[model samples]
Target: MNKTTVPSAPYTRRPPSPPQLPYPIFLNQPRRAGSRAEFVLTPSYDNVDPGQLTAEDLAIITQNQPQLVAPNVSGDWRYEQRREAQRILEFLYIGPHAVIRDHDFLRREGITMIVVARDSRLANRSMASVDRAGGTLGVRCQYIDVEGPRDLIHGFPQTIRDINDHLLSVYRGQMQEMDKNDRLLRKSDPPVRGKVLVTCESGNELAPAIVAAYIMSVFGKDMQSALQFVGLQRFCACFDENTKRLLQSWQDILRARASVARARTPVPGRPVPEAKPKRRLDQLRDHNDDEMGLGECTMDRERFLGRDAFVPFVDITNDNAS
Candidate 1:
């Protein structure tokens, strides 16, 4: 019931596209010589309950929040996970960039969401019911069940990276196929694009969300871009491994939904891999300060003396304390 407030610091805004630098940067470059592109990346794991988002948290999210839609609920805190899922759907539907909110309706447009439930039977049953209900009203909703090992829920980021990497590979192959055909795709292949949303029954695990966010940060530009990188990971009804396989079988359906309507060839040049960035901590020494006080440090290392020699961060509070 306790609420968490958004950090007081302002969110950083990013430029439209990856910045162009003097030198060419590789995909896995240690430090992207240039800026990254803006994209969403919000992947949560099984145990985290969405309904628990406090008012302060919501206030921070409202700045650029999208329309969310999920199942309606009463005061039952236990069902908050499902309720929050419904809220996200509502935001997605009414959100400015959203064209489709339902997972099944994604086929009409080039969009996709990969949702892995802990309980596949329940996931499928829920999805089927939604689809059937939508049909009665003339709204078509077709959803695919995503299956994966239960261990994947614990290894959320790695799993998400695997999926994203796989998606990228698939897109690359599709572009190559178009290139072979010498169609419009051969001339200009667009990047393979899609989104993922992984969930579980309890809404407790957050590993997947952390991993997804880290991946997006490595590739995406800003926080919203990271948010857009993925969707809410709902912890809903439980599921089993068998149900998981049934869900995985639907990858083709997701691929179909995400496929490009028109073929567009990618740039002729090959993309290079990025190098890993060196963490500042790696360069610091672990020796106690007292041991090195006598200036027995390495020649390459410089020593700091008075305030005149030490440059504090611009935001450091109480400058006189320095």
Candidate 2:
């Protein structure tokens, strides 16, 4: 509940000028405006670009923005390449904040952005093909041709400008907030705030988006506040099919557990433990004969004669002979 925002990290280079407002987010309002839901298309689970959207996967895009529909066409490499470039531009300069939070250089200024024909998985082959075909890749585009980093990089350049623009807008606001620090002085009862949703292709979105949401939640028309803000829901892995399913399962489990926790009765006079008591995993491990889970008795031991059964045997014959 320490609501103070963490200080920005130190940098060696001179900071770039902040971006102009009425920026990217101002241009591309999400399909769901009330709560701000940004939908990005990543490739399917089996595809080399595990979290990228293919041309055939344009339905999700159109679903989010019906007025502007993209064809789900495949083949005709030339047309596909052009469409891909256009999609990249739309995502970079006009997509939602989630796009910015999940991307990297798109998060900074002056760095060159790249998008190659082959994601990391196909870098060598893609390059060789391009080399043989004698085609030009933009100076910005590099053939990654590998997985993970490569695919991410290819998709990443597609949205760098949006991230930079958003970052600049935020920094300028931060400076203003620091100058007039009036919002921090006042404290409201209970001190509860509403939730903001955070989504990314991976867990990367949680940190930055959470930070931004917290800042906005605190500043809420009062730029001077430094209260810690909490988001109600975080959707960090929406881009992948498997991750999407996992997120759904996690939601269900949380809801069920929360419902049970809320329904539980509090002990009238007993204090709840301040912190969870420490216990070692080794202590929880059962001996070979220990009853599993029920913890009633050892598996092979007699219950009634247990004490008598442990009695020591006497060597009476040896004593008599002596």
Q: Score residue 298 of candidate 2 by CA lDDT.
A: 40
- Clash totals for all models, in order? 61, 16
> Which candidate should be chosen as best, given TM-score against the real structure?
1
> Given candidate 2, what's the lDDT at residue 259?
42
Task: Give the per-residue lDDT of model 1 (tens digit) for 162-241.
Answer: 54453444444445343545652522344444333333333233323332333332222222322222333223322333
lDDT of 1: 0.34
Name the regions of candidate 1 deviating beyond 4 angstroms: 1-103, 106-154, 177-192, 202-322
Number of the top lDDT candidate: 1
TM-score of each: 0.27, 0.22
Model 1 TM-score is 0.27
TM value for model 2? 0.22
Error of 2 at 180 (Å): 22
User: How high is the CA lDDT of each candidate model?
Assistant: 0.34, 0.29
